[model samples]
Target: MTKSNFQILLADDDEDDCMFFKDALDELSLSATLKTVRNGVELMDFLENNLSNLPQVLFLDLNMPRKSGTECLLEIKESEKLRRLPVIIYSTSSNLEVMDMLYCKGAQYYIRKPADFADLKFVINRTISLLKEKNVQHPTREEFVIQT
Candidate 1:
């Protein structure tokens, strides 16, 4: 995709993780504008910032300082306008219960974060590819008219 058509919402607290992801995204040559939120509260505030601006994809970390990603996902799923948006639970923990909970919370995918940098990059690449396929397989955007 062209840079003009790329956009992603990344909700993560760790700056290092974000930097690592940025490098991976660059390596993949994905033309995406990543919007970062440090915590769940910030993410919620962003959704309400502009009714017209909505991201096509959301990458949420399971743990955060103020609020949790699971809570954030629940809120997003509860919203009629946001339910259709693809949400991926990208977390460091490999806990089965957390994964199951995230799935039940309406996450399209639950991915365990890789330990090494190379593995993490690979995980990001695979997730991006899978999401691209899923988007094509089932196209459903909310009628709420959000910006790209």
Candidate 2:
């Protein structure tokens, strides 16, 4: 897909944070379809239904109302159909234990959520640019977006 024709799915429990992300995405003109899942369970349900046309990337949060980011990442990694898409854990805290667990569980990347709006915009822009500039070394095979 082209730069202006990309999709990004973000999973977070907080409404305010999601709204901020939506604004940041719009400001960047990333042209992504931002799907918001309330918790890990809903995320799986969405993925189960949308795996055929999975989003190009996913940004997830650590703490949620129901299932956690760790659970969601594990489920996605184990899935045959939805394992290729990239998953980034966007959380507020930088706990070493959580970070290590997520990395071991197959998360593509771990990003500390930005407190400032401008910083959030910068992070999102960098993320989009990274996706846009990624080199597909093995183009034929479908590959997961490894964010770490």
TM-score of each: 0.83, 0.86
In lDDT terms, how accurate is model 1? 0.73
lDDT per residue as tens, model 1, 38-138? 99999988987744868867888989878899888898889987777778777877676666666666787766666577777777666667677656233
Best by lDDT: 2
lDDT of 2 by residue, 39-142 (tens): 88898889998867888888999798678888888889898887777777899877778777677677666678887888888888876666667641222112
Q: Model-by-model lDDT, in order?
A: 0.73, 0.77
Candidate 1 error regions (>4 Å): 1-4, 136-148
Candidate 1 local Cα displacement, residue 134, angstroms? 1.9
Which segments of model 2 are wrong by more than 4 Å?
135-148
Worst 10 residues of 1 by lDDT: 139-148
Q: Report how far residue 65 has shifted in candidate 2, in Å.
A: 2.1
List clashing residue pairs in candidate 1.
Answer: 52-147
Model 2 lDDT, residue 57, Cα? 83
Cα displacement (angstroms), candidate 1, residue 127, comes to 1.5
